[model samples]
Target chain A: MTHLPYIAAAYALAVLVPAAYGLAAMRRLRLARTRLAALDPRPARRETRRETRR
Target chain B: MTAETSAAPGGFEMAPRAAMFRSVDALSSLATPAPPKAPGRSLHRFANPGRFLRLAGALQPWLTAGGLILTAAGLVWGLVVAPADWQQGDAVRIMYVHVPAAWLASAGYLGLAVCSVLSLVWRHPLADLAAAEIGPVGAAFTGICLATGSLWGKPMWGAWWVWDARLTSVLVLFFLYLGHIALIRAFDDPTRGYRAGAILALVGVVNLPIIKFSVDWWNTLHQPATISLTGAPSMYLGMLWPLALTALGYTLVFAALVTARTRAAVMERRIRALLMAAAAREDGAVQVAA
Candidate 1:
């Protein structure tokens, strides 16, 4: 029942399929909060220890 | 299967709304398992907001890359390489988008339900993050499924929309997704917000089955099963592969989005903490100067 427009629709869907997913991934990218990237664990613990010793 | 919130059928070919609610009778108190770590101290590692952030950062790009590639390939395959159908002709191609969208609409809620169980039971820090991230994505999928369905419907069903049982139930599912997103953000204390969202997710789960079984129990205008049935697809094989590719693309995209959103949740927490600390430092300096 479909013609060239229908083919175009399928192609559009193909684009949309990933496009939607990519958008979702982008949302997730914003949501990520990585702690390891910012912290030096050795120093943080040592600082806490030094305070206790005093 | 997670007992609290399964990838439930919401008034779909595979599920019925009443069936889900009925299952809830014995399963109401179901909760997910606790962390493998020690109850108090080791568990703290996971709940240690900082550790969560590190993991989130590392995983984000991988998911995005994988998601982007698969989705792009799937679309290319569906549009360019896949052959058209004999029966429904080019119109059959809509299945590529429609089917995947439909699947996510239901699966998204299922995701929420699982996170809610985890949050309520183990009180995992990531559980709320999962829920918080899932809400918007799920809603978007539902919206896509509905929009695509409308386009597909105009060509096939002779109308853009109908008062069919399946459509109504799916609409309800969309609303449920919106409600979940809204409820989670309503509170100032995020823990309380998570708790509130958890309860709503559990309750909203009731709608999943309704949408699944709507086609079967009710006299719906929508078509019946394709897979999990015999020789049921009215469209030819030439068209099926492209649609399958689209489905694969959609799924990968969902995974990618989830990974990215989860990472964002982690960063947001850090940002909030940093702001609070900065404010506190300023307050102390002001007090000392005074």
Candidate 2:
């Protein structure tokens, strides 16, 4: 049981660090998509412009 | 997207079905798998940034969770409940970390090499991205392998480090991994850097086989394989399984890390494209005024 601590440390480091990194990336992706959506304004404007010009 | 419009009396209009055909087709393609085009191996269309993003998004959490749980299980099983060795005692415990780290260092490089080969041969852009992204993760694991090896070494070998063949080869491997990591991001021209790093990855992979068999080939301080000659392993079942479990956990972690990093890379590419488009539009307006 005592040696268990050593094993636990290795496992924790291996698993937790990467998991936290991934979840953070996913959250960031959501935020980024939201920001981009805001920046795009309205799709109708661009679509109408392209349709009339073409 | 190209279609003919009907010349109606008062207005230029197409039939509703004809007008909506392109959008409908696009929607249908997104919704359906479109059948297995090839039975042996599917064409590599998903390598495109958009499809890659979708697939990677789905895979990210499952991989992260499986990695975390299995790693926790492996740790608990390996360190706590598993019996200690009669020969190496507590020192044998290091194998749980060392073996897996060592295995992954080799395995990760192999993955990198495969991507490199694909990049070189098929000229797939994402292959280079894939290869480059795994560099830091591999380097980190390789570093861990070295540190843990040294920690184990100090106690058992009567010194913190030694110039033994196996250790030295592994140390060299660590450097190669580090060098690859440094080379990829060091250049402004990302293509030049990715190609350079790919070459280095391929070159360095040769050392894997050398490192693996170095103990057998030369006089060395490192012990031979812990799992023995044949069926199962010579080691106790409890210890072996836990070692196995830890290895799996490490592997899972590696998979998750690469996916996250690669997804970030893809998003960054899209962000750059968006900015460039915005900048181009601004320039065009300025030119029109002039």
**CAPRI accuracy category, model 1:** acceptable
DockQ for every model, please: 0.26, 0.19
Q: Clashing pairs in model 2? A: A4-B79, A4-B80
TM-score of each: 0.74, 0.78
- Candidate 2 chain B lDDT trough over 10 residues, lowest sum: B1-10
How far residue B85's Cα lies from its native spot in candidate 1, in Å, is 3.0
| Model 2 ranges off by over 4 Å | A1-54, B1-35, B38-43, B228-231
Which candidate number has the best lDDT?
2
lDDT of 2 at B161: 84
The true-versus-predicted C-alpha distance at residue B13 of model 2, in Å, is: 66
lDDT of 1 by residue, B94-176 (tens): 67667877876787678678778878987877778878887887787888788778777887778889989899888988888
Q: What lDDT does the true structure give each of the candidates?
A: 0.63, 0.65
lDDT of 2 by residue, B1-290 (tens): 11211122112111221212211122112224634652323324545666565656566566667767767787777667887778566767777777787777777777777777767776666667777777777777787787777766766677768888888888888888789888987899988888888899899988988887888898889887655323335567677666656666667677777777776666666667778899999999999999
Candidate 1 — which residues are off by over 4 angstroms?
Answer: A1-54, B1-45, B49-51, B54-58, B229-237
Q: Candidate 2, residue A2: CA error in Å?
A: 8.3
